[model samples]
Each structure stands twice: as C-alpha cells, then as structure tokens.
Target: MRSTFDFQPLFRSTIGFDRMLDTLESASRVTSIDTWPPYDIVRTSEDDYRISMAVAGLTEADLTITQEQNMLLVAGQKSEQDEASGQYLHRGIAARAFRRRFELADHVKVVSANLVNGLLTIDLKRELPEEMKPRRIAIAAGEALPKAMTKQIEAEKQAA
Candidate 1:
C-alpha cells in the first residue's frame, strides 16, 4: 500500500507564501544537523539576550568566540596532554573539539563572554539607532500668535 500527499490546493490558497516555503525548507534541513555542547537561549529584556552552552572540562583559553557576517561561532579545542603511564578504568568526560554556529539578527552585538562553573555564557545586546526610537511631535497653530504667548507655550512645552 502507498500513501499520496497533495499540497497544491493548500499552497494556492495561501497568500504571500514564499517565506513560508523557505521556512519549511530550512526546518527540514536543520533536523538532520548535529547537536553538540547543548545550549540555551534566553531573552533577559526587550533588547537583551543571553546564550549559555554546557562546556564541562573546557577552559577559557581553549574556546574561541567570534561574530562574522551576522553569525556567532563558538569553537573549542583541548590542548594536548602528557602521556599517562597508567590506564584509566573509567573516562566519562568529553574533551573533543566542537564548533557551534548560531544565526544572529541584524544590529545584535556580542557584549561579553565568560566561563564559570563549567558553563560558557555569552551576552548579547541589540542597539537600535536614535531614529528608530519613538518620539513626540509638538503641533503648532497655523495662525500667528503673540510673541509672549509663543514664548510661554515654548517654555511650558519644555517643562512638560
């Protein structure tokens, strides 16, 4: 037995759906991607965010964080160690090199990075330009008014 799927009707009914198709393709591709050094992304404020990754047994000197072309890349490689004479019975820790990439939005800047308690924390802040912020406009009357009245109005507006 075989099952057939039909998407033409659904696709035709949707409006401005190019983005939807692109998102679907991306999602399908990401599922097969590898997941290592598990991470967490949190929004601390309206324009502030933090990304934490579990990097046990990894030191600051071994890790590298960089932002290139709107993408944040974190990579780590352990240093070579002296040969051990005795054989270990059990070795559970991971010391392998890892490279993790994160897609960042525009205007997002990496503020700082710190390693504490086997975790790597990276802070990011989004800075919007002055023109992007909301502002209030003062409406003036079309007819000419007295100079004293205009001065008084300007002073009151400034005080407000």
Candidate 2:
C-alpha cells in the first residue's frame, strides 16, 4: 500500500519551506528500504550531536565521509580480497558496500569521526553566526535619537 499528499495548499501558506516539504514528499514515496549498517543519532548537548554506526568487519580505509551543503554522505566500500577456499558452515558477518545520507540543519558541521572496535562515531556541532544569534535590544528612555535617525525624521517631517 502507498499514500500520497497534496502540497499545493501548504505552498500558499508557508514561506521558505519548499525544500523541507519536497524532502518529506520524496521520502514518503521511496519504495526501497535499506537498513544495512544500522546507525544511531544522539544529541549530546544543546548544539552537539553524535552518530554511531555498527559497521562490523569494516576498516577506516573502507569508509568515506563527506559533507556538502546541508547533506552528509557516508559510504563504505570493501576492498577486493581473495577469500579462503574452505567452505564455511555459517557466514554471519556482513561486509557489503553501502551508502547512507543524513540531512543536517543549517549551521551544523561535522567535528570529528573515529572508528574503534568496529563502531564508527561521528560528532557534529551547530555554531550559529553572531548575526544569527539572538541579541538584546536596549530601549531608549526619554533620550534624543541618534544623528542618523534624527536627520531622517527631520527630512521626513520636512517632506510631509
């Protein structure tokens, strides 16, 4: 079973959210479900995050992490090696190539990545620019306006 949604109504009401809505619609329509190399996303702090993936039988050389714009790509490619000829009773380990993508919020950046004990941990932090941060605006109490504002006000009064 599949379902679809109409975003035309939302388009008229929302502003600067087309990309997010498009992402949601595309994700809903995706038919393939790939869950290999399971990963976990955790918020370590207010602006810090961590992603841990269970990548058994994979080494540092077999994995690649890249960050482009607001997207994070993690891919793993196993090196070609000759396997033992002996027949095994049971083969449980998975050593396959995979590519995973993660969407990042604005200002979020990858800090570091480390692989230890078959686990890959990626750390991220959100560092908002000074202009984007919330600032306190001081209120004037019965004081004269600045020269620029006073001049503009006088000009407007004269024009009127």
Candidate 3:
C-alpha cells in the first residue's frame, strides 16, 4: 500500500521549500531497492564526509565517478576478461554492472576518490562561501549615537 501526502497546506505557508518537499514525496513511494555492491557513508568531521563502496573485482578502468551539480553518480562494470576467465562451479561474486546516485547538499564537493583493496573511497568536504559564513558585528553604545544626534540637534537649533 502506498500512502500519499498532501502538501497544499505546507505550500501555502512555506517559501523556497518545493525541492525539499518533492524529494520527501518521491522517497515515500515504493520502488525496487537495489542493494548490490554495498556501500557505507560516514561523517569524519563537522564538514567532512566519506563514502566507501565495495567494488570487488572491478579495476579503475571499470569504474566511473561523476559529480554534476548536486548529484554524485558512481557506476561500475566488470571487465570483459573477468567474465571469460574461467568457469566456476558456484558463482558468487556479483560481476554485473551497477549504478548508484547520491544527492549532495549545496557547498558539498567531492575532494578525491581512490580504489584500494576492492574498496572505493570517496572524500567529500563542505566549503561555504565567504558571504555565507557567520560574521560578528560590532555593537555601538548609546553614547555613540547621541554624539552624532547631538551635532544634528545643535545644527537644527541654530537654524531656529
């Protein structure tokens, strides 16, 4: 059974949240979940993240990683030599091609990707722009405003 949520009420009060709401609604729908080539997502620090995926039997030439806007795509395809290497009595390891997609937040960028020991590790870091970073503003005391106001008040009184 699929449950549908009405976002009319939220739309009336919220602004610039349509994309988030659409993501939530689409995630709620039922679909075939692919679990092949297991992966792990870990947060190393406040602004650093790591994604490790098990891509056994796949070499650097067999994999492709792309970062487009807010999406990260990872795909792997077994080499032709591996498929015709030998006949196995009991086939176990998955050699099928697979594609994975990850949604990245604004300011989050892929730093590097490395393949080692059947594991592909991808590093991510979030770097906010200077204008978006928090900044401290100096507060002025009452006397500071009065000084400027007093000059204006004196000028007006002289004119009168």
| Candidate with the greatest TM-score versus the true structure | 3
lDDT of 2 by residue, 1-160 (tens): 4378878799999999998898888777847889999999999999999999999888899999999999999999877762345576887988779999999998999999999999999999999999999999998789785667344344444554
lDDT of 1 at 129: 86
Best by lDDT: 3
Q: Candidate 1 residues 1-160, lDDT tens each? A: 3334344576778987755555455555535566778899999999999999999888888899999966899999876661254576887877789999887776799999999998999999999888988899999869876567344344544654
lDDT of 1 at 4: 40
Instruction: For each of the candidates, give the backbone clash count.
Output: 0, 0, 0
Residue pairs in collision within model 1:
none
| lDDT agreement of model 1 with the native | 0.82
lDDT of each: 0.82, 0.90, 0.91
What CA root-mean-square deviation does each model show from the true structure?
12.5, 8.4, 6.9
Task: Give one digit per residue, the lDDT tens place, for model 3 in 1-160.
Answer: 5488877789889999987887787787778999988999999999999999999989999999999998999999988888888888997888899999999988999999999999999999999999999999998766543444344344544654
Worst 10 residues of 3 by lDDT: 144-153
> Order the candidates by lDDT, highest first — what do you get?
3, 2, 1
